[model samples]
Target: MTLSNSRFLFSAAGLALASLLPEQAAIAQSAAPATITVQVNKPGGAIPKNMYGLFFEDINFAADGGLYPELVKNKSFETDDHLIGWKAVKGAAGLESYIVSSDRPISATNNHFLRLSAKAGGADAGFVNEGFRGMGVKQNAEYTFSVYARRGPGSVSGMTVTLEETRRPGPGPETPPSGQALAQAQITGLTNEWKKYTVVLKPSATAARARLKLTLDGAGTADIDVVSLFPKDTWMNRENGLRPDIVQLLKDMKPGFLRFPGGCIVEGITLDNRYQWKETIGDVAARKPIINRWNKEFKHRYTPDYYQSFGLGFFEYFQLSEDIGAEPLPILNVGMACQFNSAELAPISAAKGPNAAGQGDEPTLETFIQDALDLIEFANGPATSTWGAKRVAMGHPAPFNLKMIGIGNEQWGPQYLERYEPFSKAVKAKYPNIQLVSSVGPSPDGDLFDKATFKMRELKAEFIDEHYYAKPEWFRQNASRYDKYPRSGPKIFAGEYAAQSVAIASPDNKNSWDCAISEAAFMTGLERNSDVVGMASYAPMLAHVDAWQWTPNMIWFDNLNVYGTVNYYVQLLFSQNKGTSMLPVQLPGNAKNGADNLFTSAVTDAPTGDVIVKLVNYSTTPRAVKVNLAGAKKVGKTGRALVMACDDLSVQNSIQEPKKLAPKEGQFAVSGSTVNYTLAPNSFTVLRIPAKK
Candidate 1:
């Protein structure tokens, strides 16, 4: 949308918004607060015109990760076995090995286990564990740590877990300045068996955040589990606690849809252990937690064991999507499972009912049918479906009423293909109304997608979720990430996309601050071919940069704050401002830096007789765009614009400091049928001309 350089005159809408501005003055402070101009005119000799639009991804309110809670100040109780205070092993059955406080402190996280190895010289007290062993401390907040020990004898008092600030004896005056008694907790135990202890170290002083070491000086020989620290905003958060800043990112992007509980987080090793809809719903303390394969650093061991308190379950996902004005696209377990091997999977057949844990063998082939039934319940189940009933029990009686359900995520390798066909066929037969999406990708070393696309179409998948993680320049030059492509049946859902550096890890997509800008430029190509591409969404959407499992992604946020990397603005510009229909446009100049070059497309608001033109300048140097609006003369009057851009290519916007690249009004003069203006480099400028009428 274009306006003059003068102060914005209040329209009725503006006046209404102004009345509410008092409550949001702080929010205004949070926007980019800077301005860039946009110019528009009729296309004549040097002018180029075509329609502009954006492809949308329903990434569950555009939220992919982070444990969000339902209410604020509502601490979700969880136990990390790291703090081994005191416990009683009633017998071999109830408190085998040893029993720590699972009642008060919470029974979750890797830091809440006990270690004993006195009699048998093996772990005799505590839960069973696997992976590395050792005792080392002196870490930051929320660390992962392990311990070793032999079972202690007697009832409630022989041994204890202690932490000291002193350096060793005879260390030449190497004692710490201050001594803080971490824990003098007792280890009253029995048996001559080896036992391992693990827990999250709760620190007291700032120095403790730095000097944390694991030691087993208690009365027992012990084995140890790995120790590590949790990244900030450790697990699922609650409402009021759901980082408002992150919420704003989705609102600003104006996504048309969203998908949730996703990306590897789904299709866990087992059904009981999967991203269960039940565990991820209401009340954080009530949800059972699990481990994150992506181990964190500070956490000696990286197990996110907190009850999901699934406050943001299906209902919340739908609510957030609706609140942010985006459609919901959810992905459910297809039954193949993440772990290829059966032994590696968690036992769940016992948890639900008869075959709940799949006591017999791998889940029956018929197991795939359950998801189809679930899809119906989630989308149309009138508070009666088994799943819908569950949602209601959680509080919201109404189903999420969602229709878009995908089959799987990046299931490309042989494992994916071998397991996909069954789910696809089953889902199609049961619910033909819901749109189905599949994963497809560009050929990187481990990421081979072309073959998967072929298989998807062969299997008659409705839409292959196409993926492309290329360099910024590639996004611009290769507008047709999949143009003129021939698919037997499925349309395209640009599911997972970001500029990735295959040869090396990128800090940002292609390490380009202009990644989003170039993405916008390339979107023109996708919009032009929307006839074949039905939908799309960006992947690995949210990251704590600190807990970043992957890089070059779309959005990055922290516990209290969130920010938009350079790429986010480009997404905001296109998605927020797009045309209902696409118009053909061409760039005769052949701008340099493929991704940073100028790309064009146009659309006319026929009713108002106003024409809109979109120009993407993907260059480091500014270029003058000549508007030859010879055809727009009849409807042309004054021209205005809404531009989206940034000052520096690498400039980013965070909750504390946001940088807006949105288009502002620019000055333009109409000379009969021609107009001209110089556009900045690495920017997406959108211009709208007023009608002569």
Candidate 2:
């Protein structure tokens, strides 16, 4: 039997055991039945439609290997080492290869390409590229392979490209295609001028671990750049697209908003490396590549080759948000660098001469403010405008209709506010309708957080972004964190949050049931105080199994498969079942405010007129509760229950056992005005009941 069914069946035994002990029997009988009185007639407040969404950061290889879906890692040979992801093929010692830099490159931003020189009769001389955790190929699936090549010096023949499985063989009755080629294609034409060559290959067999090989047939020198391989079936079938599986997962969640290109990346280690939105748009070839700030943030999990190709840039983010039916929330740098890093400041002038106001200074705070204004123009300005014309040239003639923009990502202190004040004012002055989201720095408990909150409150900021990565216990205790906040102050956006199984950034952290359940408990409070909280989302959305820098992410994936964590299901449950209006739910004395580890919140869907109640039981023993639909005209006899329960808190979902902690659906009966249900211990349950007219 499934975990939910077993828990439902064992409730009788639990009661029988209680009857065996006099003290327990008395306590159970005198517990006032743990009544949950739901006032269905009156709606307290309207919940934000974009309440539960996603916060996507480029950390943990989330972009390159996880979501962007480009099979080749170093596609442009722009890494510091140039040949980071490429290697010399075996038996190809006759060929010499090095990086060739040019003053005039394919684009001014990208200036490196592989130069391979081969001697006569060196047919095996070529290069092999190890894709991100090896390319995943399926039987009869079509993949597009392309390369930018130019013949140089000696005469050369065409190049041959092949996809082959490189995994070691294991013990099995059926022979494995370990060393067999799944797909092969040849490019015959190579002129003296640089040109892009394209070919399509259909893999004859499926392989979970594969590599791409490029072999030059004749003797000569060839220059190769921007080698790329992609499956034909991308999301929306768009060229240079995202992984369908990952995008599908986000689409399935029905996310209300997508906060993109973020986290510490918005504020780079220094001012020079900050994520400049202008550089990420326009021609993909001209878009400059930068080393990912997360490349070496943690010495223990250093990834030297991690870089941002900006293939998935601002325009793509907006398009993705549109495709997924989510609101696009793009955050820009606010003149200050990452506080944890260099903390460089943009030039500020107070002089009184020709050099006054830093007019001649190449880069100053004024220029930074212009970037923000240009971004707004790029997103929502008319197509005739300069920045908007660029957007039109990029195939999006219509505006993204961006209603909100974030000024900074986790920046705080006087320096942050000093920079943020001017940027926020300028953005609001030019685009008064745009809602600006301000930051509260890294933690929720530090003096920096307090100072930032005070400043935003003084400024009457519209929305304040708070972030936290704490233990499960902290989440459970902070369920009422926003309960006491003044309703007149700035609204709250739980922008970046996830319960860490271990301490923050620990490599041992896992997306365990303990963390998920605690987050569920806390989310009830977020739902309870919907008026003050405008939005919330789980952070570090995607992580690669082999190239991860952080743990406890919402989704985990390898080359061939992807699965949502138990935490993901928790967010999914809340997001998918978000109701239109909040309804008051009260518990009996002592059991109120989750004193007994039982948390509950109620909401009513205006369209369906269905009452949705979410309950989280953090105790170790089952609790039988009476749900009284007080003030309801009529309660349906049948209702639906979705339960996510597990036997142990430490048990986690993995690639092999992806559904170990998934939700189970069941039916329940509700009589006239009351429904008695036994909530499984350490579980999250959602009940949806139709209200008769």
TM-score versus the correct structure, for each prediction? 0.63, 0.92
Task: Write candidate 2's Cα lDDT for 524-614 as tens digits.
Answer: 9999899999999998899989889889899999988899999999999999899999888888863546677989898999898889999
Q: Which candidate is the best by TM-score?
A: 2
Best candidate (score: lDDT): 2
Candidate 2 global CA lDDT score:
0.82
What digit string (tens of lDDT, one per residue) describes model 1 on residues 322-346?
Answer: 6666777777665545543231222
Q: Give the TM-score of candidate 1.
A: 0.63
Name the lDDT of candidate 1.
0.48
